[model samples]
Target: MEKPLLVTDFLDRARRYYGDREAIVATTGDRYTYDEFGARADGFAAALADRGIEKGDRVAVLDPNTHYHLEAAYGIMQLGAVHTPLNYRLVPDDFEYILEDAGVDAIYADYEHAEKIEAVRDEVPTETFVTNDTDAVDGDWESFDELVDTDETFERPKMDENDVITINYTSGTTGDPKGVCRTHRTETLHAYIVSLHQEIRDDDVYLWTLPMFHVNGWGHIFAVTGMGATHVCTRGVDAGGIFEAIRTEDVTYLCGAPTVLNMLVDYYERHDVATTGDRDVRIATAGSAPPEAVIRAVEDDFGWYLKHVYGATETGPLITTSDARRFFEDGSDARFAVKKRQGLGYLGTEVRVVDEDGTDVPEDDATLGEVVVRGNQVMDRYWNKPEATEEAFTDRIEGYYHTGDLATVDENGMIAIRDRKKDIIISGGENISSIELEDTLYEHDAVADVAVIPAPSSEWGETPKAFVVPTSGDPDEPGTDVDELVSFTRAHLATYKAVSKVEFVESLPTTATGKVQKYELRQREWDEEDRMIGEG
Candidate 1:
């Protein structure tokens, strides 16, 4: 009994078993059951086939977290077409570059994001422009509603499990974003891992706080749908809107980056809002660990359990979860400490902290090494980039993907990230973790959001500089002085790891997924330097 593992299998199951179940709650105030949703996806697939879209055509989807995006994803994949989701936060030039790079043959964009694609429509190879906007329709663009208004059916192509199903682009921190190619088998296995780690149940209600474009919403679209969970879609991530959705939709589970959690915490404290309601919500956050203080606040003050997971786009976007429920039963400080570390690898995932020579690092919890992983869910390659693909899997140990993140493993097998290999600062021949310094600063009352980067220095080769967003103060004059903050870091961390300088800013630059772009900060600091030097 061997069967091809396809993402459309989840949709098929939902349509068969939970036909009348409420499947989607759109931000546009529309609701659809699984039956209706399946029909819409089918109609979209049929429309594409009618328009001469071949099975292998590359279809791009540009939208926020909307129902249309979900339908478009299923429809594109239904015809065995490659789905390419564009980051909506990117500029028009970035869009043009990606469309050209991916060789997008067709596009389905929302009204809000259509302008970015329309600006470069004539230059790219795309022949079809499908806009989901009902009110505004140009002569060159086709209306999404009209396209999916058909009752005709399309035949499903014979799909291979190893066929590339989606191509997700990286945030392009250093240069142009690289397309991470994922196959049906890879995503299907990743969704199974997500279900196992998150403990997804059929009664669960998932809120779309994370963008659908990011790693296929961290594979929740398939996992939750397969479990027959109701989806509550939000157009964008807003603190107040998230709270409203949880209260109104009875949301049981959600995922977001640490920045989103920080926003929610700030909104709750400022508005005097209560976190407890009729439902008990569990949140999964990644893209940099949440500050220990924030984690404590989320559990103690907000009455929500925060699970810190870790991974990147190239690694199926999920590798480990910090569910310490088995080891720490009581709600003690030790429990929170355990929950803060990214726990063991998910079931069937093999994770190791390896040195440059591919030797496993000691579990002393202090020896830093790059995190490497091998699993069924790991991506097969980078789209159209053979060199990048070769480099990703060219680890000393064959069949493992290098994650480019520096982390340490404790005796208990709990993994904690120290810093990105590039972001680690080497001052006086000592490695300083920017993440560690930033985490220490987060404990200070005056500091709100912070990013630590290596600043060029003739005295020590390089030094750690903190760019801080104060909770309340003038950007020019932060409430906490630089000397005091430096002293505070010295008090908590090693003296060598103390911040050498501080800059007060209104905000730190971030990717679309809310990850602080440390490379941008490093570029600014080392603009005049000949060689970028660091050790981690």
Candidate 2:
């Protein structure tokens, strides 16, 4: 049977087929079934309609991973309004820019983040402010819990498959954030593609560790619910809490960034953990390509299968998968090496590595070029910005969306990421991938987090310097020292990728979505230069 291509159809099917099944367990000890979830969503939809929320209007949500956030997503989508998920960690100015840019009609913000929106709400086009936290009500703002208590039910609005459903703002390293507008068709197809690669099943219990505001949590909301799987809402990404949730809730699947994986490995090592539950859990990691050591630990130490994926917010977030390959008949070690490359494109996606003129790069496993993609899952356009949207799809060889990421295609057609066009560090007429040095430095025992950028060198034109966060603050800790870290890297990776200088910090700068702001780190080194090192 064919269902509507919209997300509301997915939610309705889950409620009809799995109404008795648990859909969410909040950190505050609240639980909801598919029926209850749908009812809450419907109630909020009615409430929004009362406040003049019409189809095609923009409703922005700023909150952490919670049941409230999920309900807001369904409610907005049900009304045929485009849901713009905001990163709550953004500063007041960033929030101001996005709300004004999208021309949002209403904003649903968590209690902790309400003030940031309130500070500039008057300047934005928004007419309503719905507070998610019970304690965050002002004279003009409405309470989220009050909306849930309403008994009104609104009919789901009629929607075309290609209608815009969501707009996600990406944190590009060197420019202002661009809103990636995705249609119902694009989002649904991406869920199917990601589910195939992730092996999502009906019995899977998924823990929402990844931020739901990030590419709609990589489109898992539709994928998991469509499979009749259970979701456990997590308030924070604490390792202890995640471990307990997996053990108690029988969680089977989850996804996060490489930084999240790093946190898990660090916690597991320091605490000497055994098992989260009797069964092994599967985790999908992206945001940054993980090192081989992190992959090994997830398999050997944690007994979890870590799947690596690569994508940006513009690609509906599912471009490729790095799973087991057929040509690795040699052994597991060699096989793991191949799996590290971002694998072939998903079902409806076409990926190519192309040179400067958009010519295909040879698959000799050495020739590096920018990755260009074209797919049904690609974003429709940047919201309200035709120039940026045109630029994003420009210079297309047969209508491909040019990804700014640089990579190398292997003989087996697996894509190994080399660097971003903006992130390459050139030193003494030699080009280096900052990712290479950061990956090498991640192996250091003391480095909890690391970002490599080009530093001004008196001899070499530019050299790699690492800004690192030690696992333990004390440098005198048994295994924590800068010299030891440098020595470890020198032994592991090539000499060029070794960290030239290390600065111990409490933490590296990060965006609202948790990606390390390496451009900011690079700016500290390149302010006086006549030219930036990498773009040439």
Candidate 3:
């Protein structure tokens, strides 16, 4: 007999089996057991119910990677309301759009970001606003501390596995942010696969370096807690702070973007710091593939295992991983190549690299195609956009979520994302991968961060342009000149793929999740050319 897979089951099981175990190590140095955490969640659920929040209402959470996020999320989910978590880095305009679009009924923003919501209170439909520190926020908001201390208990509603329990908004890189609707089954299965691949165990200590708002911290909120692991909370991540947490809290595993790994490596190089604690540490990086050099330094120099995974918010945000030990030879240079690719699909996930005509690309590792995926973890649809939903699933395939990521499939069927479909620079009828160019440039010591975008070219239609953030952190005096860097890329890669133009910047603009905002750079480069190209 099979039981219904509800997201609430995770916390229930943890409370039932590991009730007395330490559940969370808060950023404020406060600790909580599973029993206490569960009680707080129940209290928040009661508070929402007291405020007349129904099962189908939408509740938004705006906070960092803190325990409050977990409590508010589970609290909202227990009532079967849609748990809508906002990106903390989003401004008031972005918040207003999402809040109104989702028809959010109530919101819980951290004291640090509550002002953004207050700035747009009249613009959105949301009514109830709560913050952890009401006195600190100059608004008509209630204290979350008081709200979660409700004496009345709430009765959880009967929820189906297929109900849209979460509505995750996209980053709106290309257009308006669309809400990705996901069901309980989708989230639960995603959590299960995350647990299996990340190798989470009860004795493990998970450091919250990743933002909890991002796909629910890539679904670790359920996966890690369900496994009865200790959660070491972090307010924000820095190289020094991350290392200190690892040593002080005995962190064994964590997840972050490639930028976070680079930060840790750079800090480790500049300062002598311990890398691990009492237990061997493992780090999983995604949002983009980490350079093999960073991966090697992480594994060899820092003495930590590195796993490269890939996915998007529309999907489970973790459909593939490069943790296949069979291909990995510990302490061998050959294994870095395998670890660099976004490895095979997770169990029950079908990831395919397909051509424009919807046929699978040859597994020769040279052909580029769009990556599409179909799995139980994939989102059901956009919140209210049927046309957009239809186009997303039926774009190049009938039943798969179009990832819009161009990738190549190797002989072993492991996929490596080359570039985004729009980011692929078409110069003189030749497709130049911006990722390849950026990767080549990353090998240079003068480059601290880099973004490669397609710029209008007089002869080639479009040429690859490089925006380099120097190691010296000054744009005016980039240590290395354009000619030297151009020669460096020419020596490492094909001449056509080399950057035709270079611009030095203080830093590259990135998303809250630490992904370079190449769209911004592309817009700035193409802004004036649009009129000229159109006239031509």
State the lDDT at 257 in candidate 2.
63
Error of 3 at 446 (Å): 32
- Alpha-carbon runs more than 4 Å astray in model 1: 137-139, 423-536
Instruction: Write candidate 1's Cα lDDT for 112-171 as tens digits.
Output: 878878888888989889998745644478888788889888999999999999999976
Name the top lDDT candidate: 3
Candidate 2 residues 1-536, lDDT tens each? 97658877778889999999998887679999999988888888999998889899999999888889889999999999999999875667678889888889998998878888888877888998998665654547888879878978776678998899999997533456678999999999998888888999888889998889988999988898888888899877888778778889888888866656767777888885654576669898763455567777777777787777878788988898877557554336775676567788888799999998889899998887888999989999988789877877875464778777778898878887765566655543233567766776777666788888887664354677888887786534524666776777677644545567777777789999999988787777778753334211
Model 3 error, position 8 (Å): 0.3
Q: Local error of candidate 2 at 108, Å?
A: 0.9
RMSD (Å) of each candidate, 1 decimal? 10.7, 10.7, 10.9
TM-score of 3: 0.81
Clashes of each: 0, 0, 0
* C-alpha lDDT score of every prediction, in listed order: 0.83, 0.79, 0.86
Which stretches of candidate 3 lie above 4 Å from their native place? 423-536
- Distance (Å) between predicted and true CA of 531, model 3? 29
Of 1 and 3, the candidate ranking higher by TM-score: 3
What is the model-wide C-alpha lDDT for candidate 3?
A: 0.86
Pitting candidate 1 against candidate 2, the one with the higher lDDT is 1
Instruction: Report the lDDT of model 3 for residue 492.
Output: 72
